[model samples]
Target: MTILFHDTISDSHFPSTSHPEHPSRVQTAWKHLDGLGLTNACKKGIASPASLEQIARVHTDGTIKRAQETCARGGGYLDADTPVEPRSLSAALWGAGTGIAAVDQVLTGNDRNAFCLIRPPGHHATRSQSMGFCLFNNIAVAAQHAIDHHELRRVLIVDWDVHHGNGTQDIFYGDDRVLFFSMHRHPFYPGSGLSSETGTGDGLGYTVNLPIDVQRTGDEILSQFKQRLDRSAQAFEPELVLISAGFDAHHRDPIGGLRIDEEHFRHFLDFVLDVGDEYAGGKVVSMLEGGYNVGVLAECVADHVQGLLQRSLKTGSLKD
Candidate 1:
């Protein structure tokens, strides 16, 4: 259950410190992890910028060119909510590249799993459009890399970002090679996670969504999460597990209304790790997606890393 992260992930930044998706998100977490010595405890890898070919797998050439050209012109908003800067393109590249590296590392047995601590929270970026403060879909890129580069036949993506992982869902909607699951707040930002929105064609039923339309206690949320996750993981029998780990679901978050907290996330991790142990050989790659409260996000990151470490010591891997 060795956890791997790239140090260069901290280089990602936005213009406004007040922005929810600012560099301090990672910087604060890195400092907290460092204070606990988990920064050194976890394996550190270099985060190289992603190649255009890799980006092409999940993004359109137009999308790539748009990001490139916009940043070249001193940066602008890709959408009303998403902003960019001179270095945002570089950040987006490294962020996606970190996901690729994490997939490669975990799949090749170099590490048991990895936590991509990069920013510009990605699950919101569609193939042709970047929105909701997301530049490129990092988790989607990682899952695709696993399917194409690693030759994995079945991959499972679990996104618990409070907001629907609409872009990731769209990219893999018709592909059976990847199974996408999202437990999100319905009628929320970008608003596209409905229980009825299952995958189409070859990917029918592969897209599982739990649209939380009402507020539920953390305990109740965990109960629903456990049942659904257990059944899906058992049936799918995925070769690898990728997580869109967003702490914005925490009750402390200003933008979200969910009552989930740190313990619930740990419980979420425990369940996912159990699924990984049985179906994916403990091969899980997690990427940062969305979390507004930097303090709570940092704490959740620490607990997640500790959970991986402790689980490894207790059960030889990340299982409940």
Candidate 2:
């Protein structure tokens, strides 16, 4: 029941007052975790800025340097949606660092599972471009960290955001060691994750994309997710699990059309916990990615983490 947070994420506020991906998103989630008694397990700290080498594991040097330079110029938009202010670079670096720190915590036996609360939601950022409020792909970086730093041969990334994690898929598409799975709304923003776009090269069939219709109920989403994840994990037998945890699929979220409620997240967590227990020894590391509605985001994450922590307690692990 260990959580790592990049406390200064709030500093990466976008320029426009009307941006949906604002700093308040993480603040609300933090407050709700505090109310749910998981915040104390949450270690408040700053992630050392992800070094160029670390970032280069997933991003090209040109893109990484350009992003740094853009943030250095004091403010701009990588796209119409992803805005950068004076504090954006440090915040993006911290977001990446949070993922790295979570991996370290899990690898060092400090925790069996760790949730990182930080964002400029990644998933849309590709190897060369930032999109959908993400500059660096946090989960991608963490997945690489597990492979490099911890020597984990197989890792699985499960993304349940309303939007596709095109960047994550793109980064590890050909690597057999990384299994990328996503369940996202089809025909949405950055719409690239179709069912046909499975893996390629040595990683063919490793990437699983379940592009559900936007009209699904919470139970339906959870059930489909559980089934696919179980089938995939049993087949791949990953040593670790990484989640691109996004709350935007909640019914109250404006961006997503799915009907996932708090109970849905609870069920999702329960299912993931069982899978972790069975395959990964209950090792699941989650990172905050997207969720715009403050109330819904907070409540959903509170429920999700409570499930994770409860499972950790059952497993007798104090760290994660």
Which is the leading candidate under TM-score? 1
lDDT of 2: 0.81
Candidate 1 yields a Cα-based lDDT of 0.84
User: Model 2, residue 105: what's the lDDT?
Assistant: 74
Model 2 lDDT per residue over 1-320, tens place: 55656575555556677888887787877777777667786554446767778989999887787777777898887877887877888788778888888888776764678888787777787888888888899999999999999999999899988889999999998989999999888888887999898889998998999888877777788889989988998999888888898988888898775878888777776776677778787788888888888888888788777777777777876343
* lDDT of the candidates, in the order given: 0.84, 0.81
Off by over 4 Å in 1: 8-12, 315-320
Model 2 bad stretches (over 4 Å) = 41-46, 318-320
Cα deviation of 96 in candidate 2 (Å)? 0.5
Clashing pairs in 1: none
Residue 2 displacement in candidate 2 (angstroms): 2.2
